[model samples]
Target: MEIARPQTDARPSPVRGPTPGAVLALLKPITWFPPMWAYVCGAVAAGAPIGERWYLVALGILLAGPLICGTSQAVNDWFDRHVDAINEPDRVIPSGRMPGSWGLYIAIAMSGISAAVALLLGPWVFTAALFGLAFAWAYSAPPFRFKQNGWVGNGLVGFSYETLPWLTAAVAVLGHPPSWTMAGIALLYGLGAHGILTLNDFKSIRGDREMGIRSLPARYGAGMAALIACAVIALAQAGVIVMLHMAGLDGHAILIEALVAAQLLLMVWFLRDPVSRAVLYSAAGVGLYVTGMMVAAFGLRGLAMPV
Candidate 1:
């Protein structure tokens, strides 16, 4: 809801239509990389020649990052505007760059545009987009607002960002459901991403507690939240490693193990000072994590290598 402010002078207010930059800021493009990367991984893991349906790959990436993911960011920023006023007053909405309910309007418009694009992709991608948009709204809007709880919110976002894009891309390129191996790997990576998203909560722990948002750090204290994050991430990564080995991708499995070993060292530091080191781990640890995702994808391609 837009709040009314009292006039103190006859001068005009800066409130007006949002500029293109403000709209972009509201959409938060920096947050789009994860889903885009996941989409590529999915396409790769499908073992189809990328050059054959390169257009589908391009469209899927666009849908994952700019269209679908961008709408989700807009929705989240709109709903979190009040909270941002407390923790990040300079964000577009709170900063008055996006004035007078423009954020909500932009979100709605983007959702419609995203739908049209997804429809062009095909039935599999379209269905995933519907569920993706639904969860995007449900994660932020009233009566649901899954973002209020760390467990539910993290799981929703993790799956929506990682698994949804990954699986959708696989089907978009392959024109059918992916194999169980591909699906299971996507699930494992998505679960690990839950821990990654949880790390984002540490920055606003105080505001989250003050505003009744039940982020893991605010709900269970930062130290415990860090431990839980590490455990979830490590366990998910371990699952991928075991599955890779079982699939006879021993070389890839060893590489992922080395990556996880590196992340474990960073996790130790993150646990020591979670509030301060969460971002550090997110950058360093998550780099290795996503690296494993691509490695796993490439390894799956080996399954179809020449006999």
Candidate 2:
């Protein structure tokens, strides 16, 4: 017997094309902060004088946040409209706010726009953008829809949102590969963001399960998943602190340790009711996590500066 799929409304396209406002809503501007902030951290970590390269910096930020990240959001929404119909019926695509295949069209259009903007940034930035854009599409669309598996999906998102943008910003600013220290920090932080992505899955557990999406919260019970997320985040951060100490960035290590401590405390509170508190933990705990990232960036900058 064949497995049943979730039934989605077959809505017709609007007589008119998507409005500008509907297209903007499809981009999900609120989801842009993490990548943009990561790009800024990378720029700081590059230890380059930005006095002459302000235009490049600005363009890199735009690419990271609005173009690349926004494109991902649009693609995910377009491909996941059926799931969103159950999880968030009010969403623009599912609710017919944009209607029919317009969501898909918008995503495809944005992908081209992102590539054009990336090429203007630099070859390194353009290469990173292509990788990010590829992951964005693979995460949501086609036979390789990575979102079906929780770990793979979350890991891809973490790397795309954090490490890729960080590398792009560093290359844009310094016109070379970032130092090993900066690269290492970006990798760790990107890995740690797996937990953040897991937390986001909490909000869609019901829809994910019903639609046969194997998100962590849907496959493993929310409580167990919460514990796993806490462990992943805490351990990765512990590794970062150790690496910082080994590098003799004592002040930065201490600051990051304090931030991690605070995140652990918040995690305890979040675990008390994981499903209900996922958003709160994401906003509060993840905020501290990114702040620590910025601190580490500043420390790397000091080390990268000329003696």
Candidate 3:
């Protein structure tokens, strides 16, 4: 049975011609970067050391993340035109730099290409790519509007970004996910994603409040949101440490865990401010922690073998 996808007419009409810059904005660069990096790190952490076939893994994930993230952002811009006009009038669609319908078409095209790349990776990757598309569409769509439901939306997006990609990387290199270790990693990764998303909501709280979007930060206010972000990061860091110990990872792993924990502590300190500088700091911490952990895992693996 053929599943009928929605036709192009079902998409919104854009107000104007597409500008090169508008198309660039649809890429959603910030959202794309971490997922790709995480996938690379995940392949390393899953016992496939970086620098060999890692490029293929990185290429697959690089294609997948941009397609997924970009498609989601374009769809979001389409649905958010009204709100954008009020809060972000300079945005592509609202500013008349691009049509919403065209953006949707672009999204569909990007996702199609993403799925194609996933297919090249074989069945497991294809399956994950399908899920990524489904979640991206359902997130901001009518009835599902996952983001409107506070933590539910946060969890959904976070899990999709964090755990799903981890699974993809694991499957790509190992032909399956690592048994016994996945659950703890999934939990900690999900928490990290949730915390990051909440920080995003904190930044957009004013606009969200005015637009009547019930984001976690909008509902709880900035201080409480900051507290929640701190708690989530702390818990996730601890969980990673516990999981490493349980997995019998050596002192090198413990060292990496401690560094990540300290990084989180620094991140928590800035959650209260959430200024542009703070957001950059948060991103740097995440990148550093992920990179550090991957390097440490590979380092330990090296030491365990014959010299």
**Candidate number of the best lDDT:** 1
Poorly placed runs, candidate 3 (over 4 Å) = 1-16, 49-55, 264-268, 271-281, 292-307
Task: State TM-scores per candidate.
Answer: 0.94, 0.94, 0.83
Residue 119: error of model 2 in Å? Answer: 0.7
lDDT of 1 by residue, 145-243 (tens): 999999999999999999999999989888899889889989999999999999999999989999899999999999999999999999999999999
Every candidate's lDDT: 0.93, 0.91, 0.70
Per-residue lDDT value at 195 in model 2: 89
Per residue, candidate 2 scores C-alpha lDDT tens digits across 1-307 of 9999999889985587777888889998989999999999998889999889988888888988999898999999999999999999999998888977988888898899999998998789889999999999999998999999999999999998888888789889999998777788899899999988999999999999999999999999999999999998998889889889988999999999999999999999999999999998999999999999999999988888898
Give candidate 2 regions above 4 Å deviation: 1-14
Q: After superposition, how far is residue 228 of candidate 1 from its true place, in Å?
A: 0.5
Per-residue lDDT for 50 in model 1? Answer: 83
TM-score: model 1 vs. ground truth: 0.94
